[model samples]
Target: MNKPLIAGLLTLALAGCASSQPDQPFSLTVAHINDTHSHFDPSDVQLTLNNKTVYTRVGGHPRLLSYANQLHQQAAQTEQPFLLLHAGDAWQGSGYFKLNEGAMNVDLLNQLPLDAMVLGNHEFDLNNQRLSDFIDGVTFPIVAANLDVSQDSDLQAVENLTPYVLYAFKGDKKKRVNSVEDAGKYPVVAIMGLVLEDMANIAPNIGQAQFKQELVSAQQTVDTLTEQGVKHIIALTHLGLDKDQQLAEQVNGIDVIVGGHSHSLLGDFSQLGWEKNAPYAQQFTNPDGLGISCVVQAGKFAQAMGELTVNFTLDGQVTDCKGTNTLLVDKVFYNDVRRADKHRLTDTEQERITGFLAKQPNVALVDEDPGLRTYIDETYRPELLQTYGAVIGHVPSSLQHVRVPVANQGSQVAPLVAASQLYWANTPEVRGVSGREVDFALVAAGAVRNNIEAGELKAGHVGLDILPFVNAVSLVSLTGREVAGLLLETINGAIGDDTHAGQFPYVSGLRYTFNETRRGHGYLANIEYLHQGEWQRIIPDARYQVVLTGYHASGNDGWHTLFEAQQAETDRIDLAYVQDELTAFLVSRLSKNEQGAIEVHYQKQALDCQLPGVSCNADAQAFIDYVQARRPILTALPESGVTVNRLH
Candidate 1:
């Protein structure tokens, strides 16, 4: 738990010239990005500057490449060893990947000058065959030392995919370039991939692949490389930042760890109105207590790059690790893009905002690489346009998502997402399979993605933006006590620390209050189920059918209680893909586009003005109710049931 050394300008170089002794520290710049998630094009970001919230686009693969190329050139000119690495999850979450799958990710990621990349859990989303094709397709090495792919022949046959890669920066550049050469002439850095050890639950379609324990694999790899005369070692990992810290604390001889999968943005973004976040390029003490291991990860969705200059002693201990988590953004700014407002920011305002931004070293105004942008627009975007062009639904306001939210509302979208699962489960076709009506639905906070703006929600947006993972909805039978336990654990995970917050639960037809000061199951209180327009307290022994995704059912993320409940039961039925249900929920239940509710007078004869204090939000009240059995009024957003009384 030592204070991490980062967010600084490096002022010193190697103790003189590069030498083979512990006296002269080896200084190298390691540039990294993680959880890119197929964002080849820029995405919208809202920033606050000079007391105004301005909308601007930020972070694309093209822009990321453009910056990395510049860094690479700068390092080359100085003869400093520079390595650009991706810590996995370059697939899913965009239309490009939806249509092309791993094919598109391979094509675009291959374009980057990536030295090494680990395998993220999403890489196994399409099973081993497709993942094998992607690995073979990529030009760079795919490193995952702990992944046992020997049982799967297709993955086993991939040439460039290996446990670790050795880089001989001081060796002859022209000799056996991609692999090692002249090993005796210079010390080398061994970069190995260490992925999440559990495979069955996270990626069920993993197909004959098994992952060894992360710490064991890391220690073994470090030992093997050390025996081979390698002084420097880096573990390119898909484990989240918390896990990375754990790895740093548990192991010895690892100089650095580049990590992904948590979608965590480190460093300060107070200038952009973002609350304080985790520190970037944090350092942890190795198990030996004498060595320093620096752990760094770039923010998710290619939004930023992590640049760490590690000064390592000849014995492989890090002397200094200093760097910045730079946010990549465009120069354009606006008041709001949702209303298609173009001229909201005046010239004076723009100048003032620009002046404020110029002072922050972490914020950079840059342009995309022209070639990559053109390819994205011409080759990939048109197909996505054809696939997801039509508008399916309209929103009243922007629904923001936070994996761990504060105050009364846990998340704006996760509850809605859970409601969708419940709706999909009760569909006649699915209910027939289950042989019973589902009582409620559940979704992990991680399962919901994207801050849906107040505008048209398109057909393509459902799969490509939110709920991008491939998971099927299932009906699981659980006692009320079991349900309470499941929710408490997920809340505790989110509240405990900076790790595994993605497991926070959002449920439909149920309400619960959380107290931060309490311990174990006592953290939750007033647990109730919405039954026939009444909130009834849950009975401990009563059986209820819960609808959720296969991932939750498998005990992935932090929903281990559900997995244990499943293990004890025999009556569980899988209904449909979670995204399909989410899409239906938006279109059928939430949208007001089809036959306006005011026009149809759907809510009530008195214009549905029931709550005395609150005015009827027009857009909220005016949603289409085309489906039968839609009993309760659609627009009345249920008062937030999950209230946080004492969260820090």
Candidate 2:
């Protein structure tokens, strides 16, 4: 796009420069996906078709691969440049990640023909070593200009890592490889990466690697890229949609942003009965008003992909842009995908839905990539089944996990998880050694990964589906004032920005009202604690033991107060892993009443139940025991109840 530079290169051949004619518009088709997690199988989605509410399965890696391959083949036939870019977050969420870690992800992702990918925060969940191994397995280059991994011992050896990728479009035939950028000839475009700088604050065990500020890194990278004669730029970012927009408005040279994080679906899905206000390939005018940057993101959990087509002028300006963010569906239909009896959709209904989907360009009914499907079915699928296929508890209703609760819609699972932690802490064995009872249990919303549906639950459902991170439990002693500080710190940290709301705390045996209008410590009021058969206000000077994940105890993910409270060695107690505590809590749920109904009595006062001679192994087995013990599982909040108020 640097016309003066291009004009001076009279010896340059225009073979791969979009088109042979000068001043012609260059068309680029970018099929992008972000926050895919590791769901290998199809995810069930309910839709209204032919005036009937019906269910069908959509997305998965195989389906995504199938559809993306088609797009690439079509682009090649048409002689247009096409790129499949992943914005980040390709780890965690399912049993595949739990059993195989990054190994399976590496193998499966190696099958996909992606040109480049960005590093997501979740990629650091295991450690720098695991991330390095994953990096070594993949064929695509990771474009992350903002992150400095030189300090991490394992990541230093990664060879494919780069600040950006340059595509010369056949202009430099001799220097075909991307790493050695043609210094003289102008490349068609440069794709770079920018992610959250405070990644260590959010993800656990990121090692010594550090990330630079998103906006600053982007501008610097763009400036550097432009200096090298690559005027057209695409920022492959993992900073979510809001930050992506901020980058576009602030950075002048970036012409496109394919982003992840925030898990936002951008595009019109109104034809499918929802989302008219969403932005798909939305273009924002640059700060200088000289050009525009187009942005797009796909939803989470391998559910969908965003396909964006942009026509760029010779000066790196977006002339026209269009795209779709849609779920790639298969033909299979079910009444309840989670339950044992799927209640397959009638043939007539499937036909009707198929006919309806055929009319919508924003959606696709696709098949799985045969190679990927065969590998998953034969290798990882059986391994997952062996580890996590047993049926656990049966949920009576759906419990959604909303990061920042809004009007009558708060997390129904976080409190349950908190209660589980309390039960695990109060177990006779654990409490006897510590000689202290846990007064309250608190959990961060970010830790709860998924929702619980009203159907059959599997062992892996909690271990892999919900709480996938291997964070250990921590028992910490803090004064009432300090406890309040931790709560407020998390509240304000996540307030207004849902992106950081993973730090928002959900508690058991505690209640408080948060008035957003107040300043400093005044935002929260009516702080109360559950005493013996009473709801009492917490004494400011009193010391109480609290249960929390080690991540939060160490003050990760905006829980600054928790970090400060545990400065001394005596201030903290390391218990079992959080997965262990949750699994044990499920076992405690087996406490029954004389009336033969499952007693819901795992509160502060109630005894943490244990089998006379049986010990439920942490993570999956305990959940299985509880589920098998109590059919059609039911749960309610604490007696005085958990209260979360945001009066803004």
Candidate 3:
């Protein structure tokens, strides 16, 4: 949407204004949210005191809307222009996204007065056709400067999709500020969008849609905007916070960046009892040393809304930047006390506590908008419950699926998940079709989002928590050397010195000992494979069949060796979803006459020690054996299945 009249008028003002003239201050509020991940209903956020869980219920979309609307109204009253920006990924995650394929998210988003939105990588999860349809229905502009959709006619035709859009911020009317007549009064803001450069690897179904590097594309867009006399430029980015920072440091002519992905929390985290970062509006010096750019991101899942107030000079350089990342709390949250400590709060005491919280100044608590609440409760909640409420299976004990390293124990759910994938891949039906057996299976730690809680597991749990994305399992061939190298790289690069990493590989039909204290590839040693009932050291030249999700198969997470492997055969098994496959494997272990209880336990095996103050071993063997046995009866989990060693 280019405006020739506005461009011409702005150019004339720029030419006439003297360089020696005093810099005039122009202020505007940028209210932004990112990576909502479809938590339409109020989800529980644990409130902890001194590392102990105290309260649970906290954020949701309704509360986000209320807080954002309040900010908008305040800006209007003060005669200050404000822009509401959403930095993508409004699709996937919750039951609502699964039920409506992002329609519900779009509906709710339509209700909000959004200025612009960017395309997140997850937006392509539904494939090109559905994405086009979703784009067609949107009211505001969906801009992405780096996306190259030239080969896809359908995507090119989507009306709402664009590379960039210009926003003209006329001075506040209440302040008696004139519009076009006062040439230098208003500022023209150019907002450009940039998605992650690795969209092709992230979502393969986004056919022919390529992405340019964020730094290059952002600079090009900024240069063009500046050439057009647009001084105020904001990069609406789906690039994660780290990349956004890099962009700010490298790119010139950009005044601000609103970002998503990586789900980073960037603000005063202490108010929420969380770790803090560099304020809500963090400024980065430009590489050219000309000016600084402000970068901000609202935490994911609508938990917090970011408010950035930027004051720019008449020449478009940022004079001052300040704002808050307010955590949204509901009124009920005020009354939520520790369950064990409830006896300490008498009726009168509870009332006084609630009153005290209600009266606290600067504590943001916004009541859910009635219309939005009704829309969710009456229209969407019932459908979500009906579809995802069916019982799928049962968990005998709480599965500890958190991603962390214990002093001497590894991941809890990762090994089990990898074993499940291997079990399904080796079935007669699957093996016969490909005429090849799976030597091992691998899963990225990030694939498992939430732990399977103890008690009755529902279909919704499988859909939303277990396998949130529609990733398929695929079979690929790699040499034993490549496999070993993959593991080494994973531990060295993914895990490294970090206590927990999403790229950590969980495997089946294979075992290895990793010395955390050792440097580089030497950290991994004593690699072995179970071949024909015997554990033998892997031969560097031997080729082995492997099963993994399409995400890893494409070399997304530093697994380029697998991606470069010989294409001997590729099969996309038409089994149920990954979660369903996991359910099937668990269900098959139950006998008709017996109740089902999937047991899980951890054990450790000593192989060898290499580095100082560290032992090397394989702990996944018990988990591998448990799945391989397919026991019809399991009253309780084994005492020791896999032991993890946490490196300090």
The number of the candidate with the highest TM-score is: 2
Give the alpha carbon lDDT tens digit for every residue of 1-648 in model 2: 000122234225433233322345667778898998887777655565655655566788899889877886686567666778899999987778888889988887877778789999889888888898888878888989998889889887799788888765432121223422433333366789887888877788788888888888888988886675565689999998899999889988888999999888877776665456467888899899987999999987787988888888766578988988877988766655343345777788678778889888778889988878887999889988887766766564456678766764678777777766766666676676556688888889988888774455677787777776655566677799998888888877776643487888888777777766632223776677777757788888998888777567667777767655543333465444232333232111222258843333232322232534322233233233434653336344533233455454
394: Cα error in model 1, Å: 7.8
| lDDT for model 2 | 0.71
Predicted candidate 2: what Cα RMSD to the true structure? 9.1
Clashes of 3: 11
Task: Give the runs in model 3 whose Cα sits over 4 Å from its true position.
Answer: 1-23, 50-52, 171-185, 333-363, 390-443, 446-458, 468-503, 507-513, 516-520, 525-648
What TM-score would you give candidate 1 relative to the actual structure?
A: 0.73
Candidate 2 stretches with Cα past 4 Å from truth are 1-22, 48-51, 170-187, 270-277, 339-342, 394-399, 406-408, 419-442, 446-456, 468-503, 508-511, 523-648
Point out where model 1 deviates above 4 Å.
Answer: 1-24, 170-181, 184-187, 314-316, 339-341, 391-409, 418-456, 467-505, 508-510, 514-524, 527-639, 643-648
The candidate, 1 or 3, that scores higher on lDDT is 1
The alpha-carbon lDDT assigned to residue 179 of candidate 1 equals 29
lDDT of 3 by residue, 181-222 (tens): 233444556678999887876764787787888888889888
- Write down the worst ten-residue block by lDDT for model 1: 618-627
